[model samples]
Each structure stands twice: as C-alpha cells, then as structure tokens.
Target chain A: MDFSSKLLENAVYEMSQLPGIGKRTALRLVLHLLKQPKEQTERLSNALLNLRSEIKFCENCHNISDVAVCEICANPKRDRSLVCVVEDIRDVMAIENTSQYKGLYHVLGGKISPMEGIGPQDLTIGSLVDKARKGEVKEFIFALSSTMEGDTTNFYIYKQLKGLDINTSTIARGIAVGDELEYADEVTLGRSILNRIPFEGSLKAN
Target chain B: MDFSSKLLENAVYEMSQLPGIGKRTALRLVLHLLKQPKEQTERLSNALLNLRSEIKFCENCHNISDVAVCEICANPKRDRSLVCVVEDIRDVMAIENTSQYKGLYHVLGGKISPMEGIGPQDLTIGSLVDKARKGEVKEFIFALSSTMEGDTTNFYIYKQLKGLDINTSTIARGIAVGDELEYADEVTLGRSILNRIPFEGSLKAN
Candidate 1:
C-alpha cells in the first residue's frame, strides 16, 4: 500500500518484519502507536533495544537469564542428576508452571527442522552431548514436541548418550482435559490407549 | 507466565500493551526476536523511535506528512473548492486509493463518540468550519462513517457552517461490490433501493 509519510512507512515495514504480523496489522499497530504518547513508544523501543543488547543466557542450561547461571540451574534444591531437555526457554517455563517436575532443564534452542534449514548443528546439541559425557547426569528427559523434527532431535540426542549410562525418556501425550473424546486425533487416541497409565497413577493427580 | 530473564519480561510486557496482543503472543514475538540477530531488533527499535519523534502531519488536511503541507493539499490540480471531510488520515488514504474523488480532504481526526468521550471540539472540526466560513469552499462532502458518531460529527460541522452558501452531501451507502443480495441487511437494502442511481451512471464505472 502507498504511504503518505516515509516515516510511517518505515515504521510499518520494520513492524511487519516480525513473525505473524502482516502489512495491514503492522500499519494498524504503527497508527495506534502514533496516537499514543511519545513516552509510550520510547518505553517500548528502549525495552526492545535493551533486551537485545544486554540479554544473557544461563551458562549451564542455555536458558535465558540475567546472570551467568539461571535461577533454576543455580538452585541447590533442583535435581542436578535429572535434566529435562526442551526446545526453548518457553518450554522450561511451561514445565516449571506444572509444579510436578523437580529436575533442571537443558534448552535446545530449537528442534531439528531441515525444512526450515535448521539442523541438529544449528542448535546446542553438541553441548548437550558434552554434558551427557560428563557423567553428571543419570537421566535425560526428552520434553520436546511430538512433531517429526522434535522426534529427530530427541533421537539424535539419545544416540549421543548411548555410550554413556544415562537413561532417556519423553513426556507423555494424550487428549487434553475438558476435550471431547471424539475430537481427539487417531494417533493420539491410539497412543493414549497403548501407553495407558495405571488407574491408581491417574488417581494420584487429583 | 514467569520469565527467567527480566529483559525478556520487560520487552514482552511492553509488546503486550499494544492493542490485540496478549501475553502469550507477546512472549512468542519476544522469543522470536531473541532468536534473530541483534541487528534486526535494533533496526525495529530505531524505526519506531524515529517515527514517533520525527513524524509530521499536514497543516491543512491533518493527514500524516513529511512536510508542512500534505501532497494532496500542495498539489494545484486538486479541486480545492470541494472538500471531503473525513474521520482520520486512514480515510484519506482509503479515498485516495479509489482514485474517483479529485477533491481535497479535511481530516477530523475522529468522530463524535460520546461513549469514548470524544466530541467535535476534540477534533479538527473548527478548522473545517473556519475553511467553510472563508467562502472559498463551494462544497463540503461529509465522507465520515455511517455510524451514529460519524453522523453526529457531520451534523455538528454542518451546523457550524450554517449561512455559508455551500452544498453539503455524503457518500452513498449500498451493498458492497460482488456481495450477495441475500446477505444484504434490511436497512442497507432499503437505502440502496431508495437512493438507486440511474442505469447509465452505474454503467459508467465499467
């Protein structure tokens, strides 16, 4: 679309560069910012710039952190021998919210998506292999997504840990609570049945 | 959701403050930015900051501009006597895209929405009235939305321009191009039938 002002056009172009935001939505967002006080825009710009310039990741788990080591990896109470392997920091937050997992996390940064030109080398897989070979970890939980890329990454990590004595596992998948049984996909339903937990195990959560 | 890094949390919080963006989407956007190179985020920040700090608006039409006056207002070929009064700059762009109206525009910034505490006094209605009083405007086109707020604003301006010998009109409303007749609402259908144009005028566009 033609823009009357070059400044407005530039702002919209930069905004549309973000994932999921198209040109129209970018224009709307830029116009909304124009209507708001300059202080609001300044705050947003400063926050984003500062985040990019000053952000740090945990030295051990590669999770985002303000310090050399993240709070989770630095904590003494967390199970150091058990590491939950995740695709990104968001997954670590998700598993942390559950309050069920007491182990630390190893952030893979991303799954092995060859279609997107992201392979195992593009991630922090080599460091995970080094961590496994260190003999400190006794169990490695593959908490990545169940997609093909996620499975490939998990298998790659599992193969790397084969020479070592660490046990490997994955998170469970099933129909979500409050969802109708008929709406569940065939693969998930079949897996839910084949990997059914004991009645007492399901009863323990409530 | 809890963020491990304060920088990431701050960026997400600011991003979520934008209209229609929730915390989850904000987190996703921030995480996507984190995955990208630092230069991309820097460019986005700079563009937004420059747009907010250095943006300009047209002196006459109140449309976004890079100079003292907008391109349409500065152009000598436009019909200055005919003014298309609109709600904001977006409307000016929309009308310009049609390429059917060769008249100048007067942007009111917003409609008279009492629910939103917006009145005629809050907009550029006074400037439009002043222009009408100058006796140069031969026609004032009320091209605002058909909503109650839009009509109230148009009428308020029309009242302000009382005794000024100028024609007043609104853009016609009807079923959208290529829209099914059965889907047209009763009020719009009735208005379309009542304000039916001559067959020759309808055929002139094609």
Candidate 2:
C-alpha cells in the first residue's frame, strides 16, 4: 500500500515486522498511535527501549528478570529440588498462575524446531543439565506443550540428564477438566486411560 | 498475568494499549521482541518515535503527509473543481488505488458519531465549507461509508453548503463487483434497481 507520509510508512513497516501483525493491522495500529496523545507514543517507545536495553535474565533459570536472579528462583519457600522445564517465561507465568506448582522453573527460551532452525543448543538445556549434574535438583518435570517440537526438546533434555540420578516426568496429557469424554482426541484419551491414577488420588487433586 | 521483570511488564502493558491487542498477545509479541536482536527493538522504537514526533499532515486535504501540501493537491492535472469527501487517509488511498477518480480529496479525518462523542465541530467541516465558499469547488462526492454516522456527517456537510451553488452526490450502493444477485441484501438490491444507470453508461464504467 502507498503511504502519504514516510514516517507513517516506516512506523507501519516496523510494526508489521512483529509476529501475527500484517500490513493492514500495522497501519491501523500506527494510525491509532498517531491519534492518541503524544505522551502515549513516548511512553510506549521508552518502555520498549528500556526493556530491551536494561532487561536481564535470571542467572540460574534463564527466565526474564530485573535482577541477577528471578523472584521464583530466589524464593526460599519454592521447591528448589523440583524444577519444571518450560518453553519460555510465559509458561512460567502460566504455571505460577495455577498456584498448584510450588517448584522453581527452567525456561528453555524455545523448543527444538528444526524447521525454524532452532536446535537444542539454541535453548538453555546445557545450563539445566549442568544444574542437574551438580546434584541440586532431585526431580525435573517437562511441562512444555504436546507438539512435536515440545517433545523433541523434552527428549533432548532427558537425554542430557541421563544417569544423573534425577527423577524425570512429563506433565499429564488428557481431556480438559470440563470437557466431555466423547470430544477428547484418540491419543489423549488412550494416554488418559493408560496413565489412570487412583480414584481417591483424583479426588484429592481438586 | 504476572511478569518476572518490571520492564517486561511495562513493555507488555504499553503494547497491549494498541487496538485489538490483549495481554496474552502482548506477552507473546514482547517475548518475540526480547528473543530478537537488540537492534530490532531499537529500530521499532525509533520508527514509532520518529513517526509520532515528526509526522506532518497535508495542509490542503488534511491527509497525513511529510510536506505542507500533499502530492494529489500539488498536482496541477487533478481536477480541483471536483472534490471527493472521505473519512481519512485510508479512504483517500483506497480511492486513489482505484484510479477512477481524478478529482481532489477533502479528508474529514473522521465521521460524525454522537455515540463516540464525535461531532461536526470535531471534524474539518469548517475548512471544507471555507473552501467551498471560495468558489474553488463546483461539485463534491460524499465517499464516506454507508453507516449512520457517515450519512449524518454527509448531511451535516450538505447543510453547511446549502446556500452554495454546488452539486452534491453520494457513492452508489449496490451489490459488490462479482457478487451474485440472489445473495444481495434487500436494501442494496432495491437501491441498485432505483439508481440504475443507462446501459451505455454501465458499459463505459468498465
């Protein structure tokens, strides 16, 4: 599309570079910012720049943090021995919101996706293995998604932690809590049946 | 959702302020940016800042531009006596892309909508009237949307130019090009039938 102003065009181009935003959406968003108060734009620019320039990662877990170590990893009450492995900080936030998991997290940054040229070395798996080899973690939970890339990343980490004397497990895959049985997929339904827990144990979970 | 870093949270908050972007999408976009090179974020920030702080609007048509007068208005070949009134630069761009209208455009910036607290006073109706009073424009084509607010805006402008000896017409409402007649809406079908043009005129419109 032809833009009347080079500034508007540049802004739209930059915005469309983001994931899921197309040229039309980028134009709408840029025009929206233009209509809003100038301070809004300034704040947004400053916030993004500050985040990029000053942001830090937790030295231990590689999760985004403001300090050398993140709050979750620094908390003494959180189970240091039980580490949940995730694709990114978003997963860490999701698990934290559940309030069910009290363990620390190891953010992998991303899954192993050969199609996207993201190899196992691109993730923080080496640091996680190093942590396991140091005998700090007693158990590791693979809480990544159920996609092929997620499975590959999990398997890669598992292989790295081989013979490390640490218990390894994956999050349970099954029908959602409120979903009907008939709607569940075949693989998930079969896995749910094969990995059935005690009736009282299921009752205790809620 | 809880963010480990305050800067990250601020960035996501600002990003979510854009129309249609929610917290989850904002987090995803922010994380995507964080994963990219630092220069990418810097470029995006600078582009937005530059657009907001240095952007200019065409003095003649009120379209977004880098100069005092827009390219269409500066062109001597464009018909100055015939003006097409539109809601914004997007409409101007759309009409320009069609290459069917050789007339100049007068962008109203927005339509009159009481529901959104927008009135004629909030738009550029006064400037359009001032231009009309100068006897510079002989005709005006109301190219706004067919919505209630668009009609209201059109009627308001018509009232403002009542005493002037200028012709006013609206864009035709009918089934879209390549659309099946059976699927056309009743109102549009009726309007199309009522406003039918001569066969020679229809043939020439192609």
RMSD of each: 1.3, 1.0
Instruction: Judging by DockQ against the true structure, name the best candidate.
Output: 2
Clash count for each candidate, listed in order shown: 0, 0
- Candidate 2, residue A42: Cα displacement in angstroms equals 0.9
TM-scores, all models, native as reference: 0.97, 0.98
For candidate 1, write residues B54-158 as lDDT tens digits: 888798888889888999999999998999998777788888898898989988888899899887788988888788888888998999889888888888888
lDDT of each: 0.90, 0.92
Clashing pairs in 2: none
Instruction: Go through the candidates in order and give each one's DockQ.
Output: 0.89, 0.90
Model 2 ranges with Cα > 4 A deviation? none
lDDT of 2 by residue, B51-116 (tens): 998888788889998888988899999999999999998999899899899999999989999898
Per-residue lDDT tens digits of candidate 2, residues A66-172?
Answer: 99998988999998999999988878888899899999999898999989999988889889989998998999999999999998888888888888899999999
DockQ of model 1 vs. true complex: 0.89
| TM per candidate, chain B | 0.96, 0.98
Among incorrect, acceptable, medium and high, the docking class of model 1 is high
TM-score of chain B of 1: 0.96
**Whole-structure CA lDDT of model 1:** 0.90
